[model samples]
Target: MANRCLICDKKKQVGVSSRHHRGVAGKQWMKRAQKTKRTFSPNLQWATVDGIRIRVCAKCLKLIKKEQPKGNLPEIASK
Candidate 1:
């Protein structure tokens, strides 16, 4: 399955991380900082829309709930 949200088209995002050392003179120095690979994925859930099952993010699901009076996830409107 695709690691994405169909309702909002959300996908995984890559990021980095690093660290620094504190200097003796009350200062911080980047002596040897390294970048690390990381992924940020949205909170997704299985939802049925228009008789089709699709991966929808939690945020979108919340919005759908607000927009829908029946509290049922109908056909997800596309952009």
Candidate 2:
């Protein structure tokens, strides 16, 4: 698995480490918080959506709301 943020596409980074008493010591490897690749629904998992594998974001997963139809029609009124 690659070290990358699925949402923002942030990449892994390396930084220097230092101690309280001692000065800069050595380089330390760091990576962005990773999101689990797998999910409860395999069909929804993706890396790209432009006709390819794409990871679905939380906002996209939100349930779509249905709006009530305007102008009561006679056909619908009977029902």
Candidate 3:
């Protein structure tokens, strides 16, 4: 299983967490803050599209359901 969304092409992103503290040693300066690495992963789910099962994000799934035409209508062909 990959950490990517099939429909929206979503992927993991890198982030940082910084720590803040008060001044020390009676000086009006703060110590160097620490940074922690973090990853933001997308919410993905398994869904079937055009008879194919693949991973898609929640937003895309919602859009697909909303945009699908009602009743059994053939898709329009564009040149």
Better of 1 and 3 by TM-score: 1
Compared with the true structure, model 3 gives a TM-score of 0.64
Note the Cα lDDT for every prediction shown: 0.73, 0.33, 0.70
**Error in Å for residue 77 of model 2:** 45
Using TM-score as the measure, the top candidate is 1
Best by lDDT: 1
Q: Give candidate 2 regions above 4 Å deviation.
A: 22-79
How would you order the candidates by lDDT, starting with the best? 1, 3, 2
Q: Write the per-residue lDDT of candidate 1 for residues 1-79, one digit (tens) a residue.
A: 8888877688999988666654555443435466788898889998766567678899887777676677565455453
User: Ten residues in a row with the worst lDDT in model 3?
Assistant: 70-79
Candidate closer to the true structure by TM-score (higher is better), 2 or 3: 3
Checking candidate 3 for backbone clashes, the offending pairs are none
| Candidate 2: tens digits of C-alpha lDDT, residues 1-79 | 4443344443444444433332344532242333334323222334333233434334332211111143321111111
